[model samples]
Target: MTTTGTIRSATGYLRSWVEAQAAHRRVPGVQVAIRSGDELVLSAAVGVADATTGAPLSTGHLFRIASHSKTFTATAVLRLVEAGHMRLDDPIGQFVPELEDGGSPIARVTVRELLGHQSGVIRDGQDGDFWQLGRPFPDRSGVVAEVLRAGAVHRRNEHFKYSNVGYALLGLAIESVTGSTYAEHLQASVLEPLGLTRTGAEYDPARAEEYAAGHTGLLLGEDTRQTIEHVDTRAMAAATGFWSTAEDLTAYGAAHYLGDERLLSDDSKRIMQRLESIVTAYGTEVGRYGVGMALQTVGERQLVGHSGGYPGHITLTLIDPVDRLVVSVLTNAMDGPAEDLAVGLVKVIDVALTPRTEVPPPPAGAPPLASFTGRFASLWGVLDVAELGGRLVLIRPTLTDPLPGVEELEVVDASTLRVAAQPSFGPAGELVPVQRDADGRVVSLRFGGVTSRPVDEFRRLRSGMTHLA
Candidate 1:
C-alpha cells in the first residue's frame, strides 16, 4: 500500500499488496476490514477459505474469532451493570452459588476481578487439551466440577493473569442473574443491539458452508496443514466460541467508541476500556488491558481491541479511539500473521490520510523525476526511489523498521542523481544514472556499479522515516 494518494486510491493499492503478501506467506486465506467511525472504508479478502475444497475467500465468510468472544462477554457484563442488574464489585458467590458450595477460592474473587483478569482464576481447566481438539471443551457441569477440584491460582487482584475459566464464570453469573442462557442473553442484549448479524456466540452447523476451515501445523517445518475439527465449547463458549467476519468485527469494534449509541454508553465504554492492568506477558509497547479489550500503544495512538487464537484460525480487531478508526484481520491458518497484517494496514491508511511533507521542490518539478519514483528491484531485494520533502530517497519497504538504509536522492541533471545522507551506501556524492525507454520514460536505475530493474506500478512508502534525513 505504498503509493501515496487519496484514501480510496491508497486502499486500492493496499488490497493488491495484501493479496500478494498472503500469497507469499502461503496463508490459506485472509480477510481484512478498515473503518472510519461507522463507515466501512476498506473490506477485502484473498486466497482459499477452505484449502481442502479450495473455495475462494469472501469478505462475508465467517471466521472462528476465538478469544475475541471475551470482548462480547465483557460487553454483556457491562450492559447488565448498566441496567443495575449487577455491579462490578459483586462477589461471584452471589450469582454462581456453586463456587461457595464447592469451597473454591474463586468464590472470594469479585466480578471486577474476573473482568480485569485480576481474579487469578485458572486459564482453562485441569487437562485443557480441548484447545488441541483432543477433548471437547467443558460444559457447565464440567466447569463447576473443575471449580470444585481447582480454584484460583493466586490471591485476588495479585497480578494480571489471563483466565478463560474466569470468563466462563462470568457467563454463569450472567445466566444466573438474567434467567437466560449466556448465548440468548448476549444475542438479545448485545449482538442484536450492535447489528452484528454475522456474529454468533457458538458454531452453527447450518452455516458450515459459510465458515472458513481452520488448519494447523502441529510441529516445526510442518508445511502441510491438518484441519481442526469444529466442536461446541458449551460453557466456555463465552470465552472462545464466537465466529465473525472482518467487516462485521470492525463495525462491532466501532460501537465501543464514544458517540456510538448502538451499544455501550460513553460511561460504560470508559469503564470497559479503562486500562485496568498492564500485562507482563506483553511489554509496555503493547500497553495494557481494560476489561476484555487489549490496549496497545502504536505511536501516540491507543489501539484497543482483542486478539483471538483458535486452533485453525487467528484473528485481530484493533480500534484507534482517538481517530475513530478500526482495523480487523482474519486468517484461517494457525500461523497466519493477522496482527502484523492489521497493524500494517492501519499504518497504510494513516499515511494516506496525512498530508505528504515531500511535494517536489519548486518549479513544476522535472518530468524525468516521475520515472525515478517507481520501485526498482534486483536479486538483492527492492530499492524504493520516491520523493520525500521534495527530495528523492531510496528505501527498503519490507523491513519492520526501515529507516537506517534511507539514502537521499539529489538530482544531478534529469537522468542522474546522487545518494546522500549515508556514507555506507557508497560515497556521499555517489553518482546514480537513470535509464530510459523508447517512450522517453525513465526505466532502470544504476547504483553502486549495478543496474537495477524497476517494477511497474510499484510503490514504496516510508513516512515512518520522516524523522531521518
Candidate 2:
C-alpha cells in the first residue's frame, strides 16, 4: 500500500537515523532489515562489528539476540503441540520428573502459562554475580532446583509477570518430549526448515571472529569508566541465548507472516496473533500470548513482535501481518536506543505502507512545555514521577536513591512528553516518552519491553529508587 516515493524516503530516513544514533551512542555495530510481504524491502548495516578490530558490520555479522531467542524456544514447543506429542495445557511435571515431586506442586504449572509468562515462576539468573562476573549459569536441573527453592511469585495463571525460569522449564519439556536437546529440536523444527543458516543457540568458538563483540558503556557514578564485557551465557541457552543476523531474522519474520508447512498452519498462526491479555484498561491494545509469539495492536492495526536485552546487546523484531511488513534491528551495545530506533523504523514503514499526501509543513518548533508527573505501574516495574523546577523527574522504585537531578522534558503534544536523561557515561541520552489520557492521567509509559500502566497490581518494588533525571 505504501507509495514508491514514500517507501524510498522512509528507508533513507531510517538508515540515516540509525547510523547517527549508533555513532552517538558509541555502538560499534548494528544491522537492520525491513521486509514487505515475501519481498525484502531493505537490508543494511552500519558502524564496525568490532570497535577495536575495525571490522565493518554487514548483514552477515551475527549478534547475540538474547531473549529474542525465546521465540525459537516457543516455536519448538508448539511443534510438539502440533504433532500431538504434547498439549498446550500439559503440566510441567509430565515432562521433567525432577519437577514432579519438587514439593511445590510444579504439576499445576501448565505449558501455556510458561509460554505466556503467567506461570508466576521466579525470574532466573538476575543475581549480581550472574551478570557482573562470569558465573556459571544453571542447567535444566539447576534452574528447576532454584525455582523450587525460591518458590513461585504468585498463584498460577494469576497475572502476566515475565519469568525466564518458566521458559527454561519449557526448554526442558522440549528435550523430554523430543528426546533431544533444546538446540537440536529447534534446528530440526524451525531453523533448518526455514533456511536460517546464520541462526543457532550455540555460539561456535571457531567462528568467534565472525561474531560481533558485545560492548557496554562506562559506569557513571563517583567514577566514570568504560567496560567491555563478553556475555558467555550458555545457561540461558533456551531462555535468552541465541545468536542471529538481520538476514536470518527477516526470513523468520517472513515465515511467520507467510505460514509454511514445516512451521505453523494458517489457523495456528492466526491463533498465535490473537491477544491473550488486555494489558491496558482501555483494551485498545491486547497482549495475546500465542504459541511463542506476542500479538499486540499499534493503533487499530495488529503487530506481532518481540524485544530482547542482554549485557552487551539489544534486539527488536516487529512484524505487521496486515501488510506483511517486518522490521528487524540489532545493536552491539546493550544500553543503546534500539527500542526507540525500532519504533521509529516501524513508523517509517507504516507511512510507506499507504499513500502520503502532505498539504503543508507543520510548525518547526515543539509544543508548549507541560510537566509529566504521575505514578505508573505494570507487571514488570513502576515509575514514580515528581515535578522539580519546571521539569519532570522520574525514579524507578527498584533502584534506591533519588535521580541525579531534574531532566528536561519536551512536550510532543498536549498528552505526551518526551523526557531526556543524561547519558550514563555514554554519548546517547535515555529518551522515554510518557503518554497521558484525556484526563491528564498517566496512562502508560514504555522503556523497551518494560511497560508500566495503571491497574497492574503485581508490581515489583525495590527498596532503593534510582533517579535517571
Task: Assess every candidate by TM-score.
Answer: 0.85, 0.71
Name the lDDT value of residue 75 in candidate 2.
71
Poorest lDDT segment (10 consecutive residues) of candidate 1: 457-466
Candidate 1 residue-wise lDDT at 166: 90
lDDT of 1 at 331: 95
lDDT, candidates in the order shown: 0.79, 0.66
Clash count for each candidate, listed in order shown: 1, 10
Tell me the tens digit of each residue's lDDT in model 1 across 270-363.
Answer: 8878889976654454348998888887655788999999989999999987678888999998899888788776665554454223332423
lDDT (tens digit, per residue) of candidate 2 on 1-469? 2443345445654575566556545667789988766767678999877766777888888888878888888777777778899998898988877776776765679998888777888877345356544576677667877777774887887877677778878888888898887788888888999888999886667677678777665455222223355555554677887889877887898777745545887666665666666544354544455546766555455778777777777888887766677888998875656666666666544433431222122125633333355556664545555432223434442322222322334444554445553454421144455666677666666644366665343233322224433
List candidate 1 segments past 4 Å from native. Answer: 1-6, 281-287, 354-376, 383-397, 400-436, 439-443, 446-451, 454-469
The superposed Cα distance between candidate 2 and the true structure at residue 396, in angstroms, equals 30
Give model 1's TM-score versus the native structure: 0.85
